[model samples]
Target: MELTTLWFLIVGVMLIGYFVLDGFDFGVGMALPFLGKDNTDRRLIINTIGPVWDLNETWLIVAGASLFAAFPEWYATMFSGFYLALLLILVALILRGVSFEYRHQGKGEQWTRWFDQFIVWGSVVPPLLWGVAFANLVQGLPIGLLPNGGWIYEGTLLTLLNPYGLLGGVVMVLVTFTHGLVFISLKTTGDMRERARALATKVGIGAILAGAVFLVWTIVMHLDHELLWLIVTCAAIAALALIGGFVANLAGREGWAFTGNAVGIAFALLTIFSALYPYLMYSTIDPAFSMSIEGAASSQKTLELMTWVAVFTLPLVLAYQAWTYWVFRKRLTRETITAGAH
Candidate 1:
C-alpha cells in the first residue's frame, strides 16, 4: 500500500486504541455515582483505575498528535469546526485530572464530593462529544474550500446537534458506561464485583442496541461505497461481540466479558473507519468539496519519516504499558479499599 494509505490505517488503529483503553476510564468514572453508593465503594472505584488511567490516556494523545501531523487539513478543519465542543472536552479533561489529586487532599465529605463531580463531568462529556464528532465526520459537514486551497467549516455547534450526531453521542456514552462496568468487575472482588457485573449486563444491552442502530444507519447511509461488504461483515461481528460480552458478563466470566466488550468496540470502530476509508471527511454540500485521505495527508516523505519513528517508538511504548498493567494486575477488594482509605 502507499504511504498515505498506510498512515490512514495506522491512525485508525491508534484511535481504536484510545477508545478501548481510555474508554473504560470514562466508563468507570460514569459508573461512580451508581456503583459506588458510599465512601468506601467510591474509593474502591477510584483506586481501581487510579494506577493506569493516566497511562490509558496516552492513547488519545498519540492519536490526536498523529492526526495533527499526518493530516493537517483534516486536523485544521475539524479542530476549527468543532472548536467550542473540543474546548469543552479539553476543559473537562483538565478538571478530571485535577479532581483525582484533589480528592486525596481534602479529608472532608464536601470536598471529596466536589472533586467527584469533576470526575463525572470530565468523564461523561468527552466520550459524548467524541462520538458526535466522529459521527459528524462520517455523516459529512458543511465544509468548503477556500481561495488559498485550504478547507473551512461553515457550520456552528448547532450544526452538529442533528439527530445522527446526537445518536452517536448516546451510543458513545452508553458503550463507555458498559465498558466501565465490565472493567469494574474485572478489577474488583466481593460485592463490588457483583454489582459491577450485574450493572454491565443491564447497561450493555442498551449499549448494544444503540450501537446496532448507529452501525446500521451508517451502513445504510454509506451503502454505495465500494467497501459495503466489509462494513456489513464488521457490523455483524460487532453485534455478536456485544451480545457475547453481555452473556459472558452474566455468566460471571469477567475476563471473557471484558474481552468481548473491548472487541465489540474495536469492531464497531472498524465499521465506521471502513465506510469512511479513502475519504477523511465527506462533504455535505458537494462531492467535489470532500476531504479525502490523499487530499488531506502530508507529503510522502513526511509520512515515511513518521512511519519510521512510529516503528521504533510504538513497540517500546506498548511494552512499557504492558509491563505497567502486569505490575498492577490483581483484583482489588472492598477490604483493601477500606484499609487504604483510613
Candidate 2:
C-alpha cells in the first residue's frame, strides 16, 4: 500500500480506538445522574472506570498526533477554523479530569458533592459539543481560500448550530450514556447492577430511536456516496446491538448486555466516520474547496516513515491496554468505594 493509504489506515484505527474506549467514558459521565443516585452508587460507577479512564483517552492523543503528522494542512485549517469549539472541549476535559482527582480528597461531603456535579458537566458538554463540531464539519462550513492558498473560516457559534448538527449532538450524548449504562451493568453486582441494567435497557431503546432519526436525516441531506453505504451498515449494526443489549439486560445476562452496548457504540462511530469519509472538512461555498484525505495528506516520505513506526508501536499500545484491562477486571462494589479501594 502507498504511504498515504497506510497513514489513513493508522488514523482510522486510532479513531476506532477512541470510539471504543472514550466512548464508554462519555457514556459513564452521561449516566452519572441516573446511575449515581447516592454516594455509594456514584462510587460504584466511578470505580468501574477509575483504573482505565486515563488509558482510554490515549486514543485521542494518538489521533491528534497522527493528524498533525499525516495531514498538517488539514490540521492547521481545522484547528484555526474550529478554534473556539475545540477550546471548549479542552476546558471541559480539564474540568472533568480535575473533578475526578480532587472530588474525593476533602473530608467534607459538600466539597465532594460540588466536584461530582463538575464531573458530570465536564462529561456531558464535551461529547455534545464534539458532535456538533464534527457534524458541522461534515455538513460544510463557510470558509474561503485566500490568495496565499490558505483557508479562512467566517463562521460563528450560530453557524455551527444547524438542525443536523444539533441532531448529531443529541445522538452522541444518548449513545454515550447508553454505553456507560451497559458498562456499569457489567462491572458491578447486586442492587447497583440491577439499576445499571435497567437503565441500560431503557437508554438502549432510546438510542435506537435517536439513531434511526439521524440515519434518515443523513439520507435526506444527500451525504457523499462512500459515506452513505458505510453509515447504512453502521445504522443496521447499531440497531442490532441495541436490541441485543436490551434482550440481554432483560435476561439478566450482564456480560451480553455489555457486549451489546459496545457493539452499538462501535457501529455508531463507524456511521459517523462513514458520513465523513474523504472529506475532513467541507466548504459550504464550494464543494471543490473541501479538504479531503488526498488534499490534506503529508508528503509520501513522511507517511512512509510513520508507517514503519506504527507497525512496531501499535501492537505495544494494544498489549498495554489489554494488560491494564485484565489487571482491573474485578467488579466494583459499594464497600470497595467506601473503603477507598480502587
Candidate 3:
C-alpha cells in the first residue's frame, strides 16, 4: 500500500483501539449510579476499573499524535474549527482524572460523593460531545480553505447542534454505557456481577434501538452511496452484537456477553469510519473546499518515516498494555475495596 494509505490504516486502528478500550471506561462511569446503589456497591464498581482506567486512555493520546503527524492539515483545520468543543473535552477529562484520585482521599461521604458526580459527568460529556463533533465533521460544516491553505470556521457553536449531531451524541452515550456494563459483569462477582449483567442487558437493548435510529437518520441525510452501505452494514452488525450480548448475559455467559459488547463497539466505530471514508472534513457551504485523505496527508517522506517509527513503537506499546492487564487480572470485590487497596 502507499504510505498515505498505510497511515490511514494505522490511524484507523488507533481510533478503533480508543473506542474499544475507552468505550468501557465511559460505560462504567455511566453505570455507576445504576449498578452501585450504596457506598459498598460504588466501591466495588470503582475498584473494577481502578487499575486500568488510566491505561485505557492512552489510545486517545496515540490517536491524536498519529493525526498530527500523518494528517497535519486535517488536524490543524479540525483543531481550529472545533477548538471550544475540544477544550471542553479536555477539561472534562482532567476533572475525571483528578476526581478519581482525590475522591477517595477523604473520609467524609459528602466529599467523595461530590467527586463521584464529577467523574460521571466527566465521563459522560466527552463521549457525547465527541460523537457530536465527529458527526458534524462527517456531515459537513461551514468552513472555507484560504489561498494559503489554512481553514476558517464560518459557523458558530449552535451549528454543531443539529439533529444528526444530537443523534450521534445519544448513540455514543448508550453505546459506551452498554460497553461498561459488560466489563463490570466480567470483572466483578456476586451482587455487583448480577446487577451489572442485568444493567448491561437493558443498556444493550437501548443501544441497539438508538443505533438503528441514528443509522436511518444518517442515511436519510443523503450521504455517499458506498459510504452509506458500509455504515448500514456496520450498524446492522453492531445491533446484532448488542442483541447477542444481551441474550448471553441473560444466559449467565459473562465472557460471551463481554465479547458481544466489544464487537458491538468495533462495528459501531467502523460505521463511523465508513461514513467518514474519504473526507476528513466536509463543507456545507462549498463542497469544493472539503478536505479528503489525499488533501490532508503530510509529505511522502514524512509518512514513510512515521510508518517505520510506528513499526517499532506500536508493538512495544501493545506489549506494555498487555503486561499491565495481566498483572491486574484478578476480579474486583467488596473485600478488596474495603481493604483500602483501591
Task: Indicate which candidate wins on lDDT.
Answer: 1
lDDT of 2 at 157: 79
Comparing 1 and 2 on lDDT, the stronger one:
1
The local distance difference test score of each candidate is: 0.91, 0.79, 0.83
**Residue 87 in model 1: lDDT:** 97
| Residues 1-342, model 2: lDDT tens digits | 667656766776787778668878878876778877777788778778898999998889899999899988878987887788889889888888888788778888898888888878888887788778766876778977878876777788778889989988887788778778878877888888888878877777777788778767766565547557767777788778877877888898877877787787677666666676666677888877777777788888888788889889989999999999999988877777765632
Candidate 1 overall lDDT versus native: 0.91
TM-scores of all candidate predictions against the true structure: 0.98, 0.93, 0.95
Root-mean-square deviation of each candidate, in angstroms?
Answer: 1.2, 1.9, 1.7
The candidate with the higher TM-score, 1 or 2, is: 1
Sort order, TM-score high to low: 1, 3, 2
- Expressed as tens digits, the lDDT of each residue in 1-342 for candidate 3 is 778777877888898888788888888888877877877788788777888899989899989999999999889888887888899999999998898888878889899888889889998999999889878876889979888986677787789999889888988999888888888988988888888888877777788898888767766664655667777888789878878887888998988987887888788777767777777777888988888888889999899899889999999999999999889888877777774643
Ranking by lDDT: 1, 3, 2
| Distance from true location, Cα of 269 in model 3, Å | 1.6
Q: Give the TM-score of candidate 1.
A: 0.98
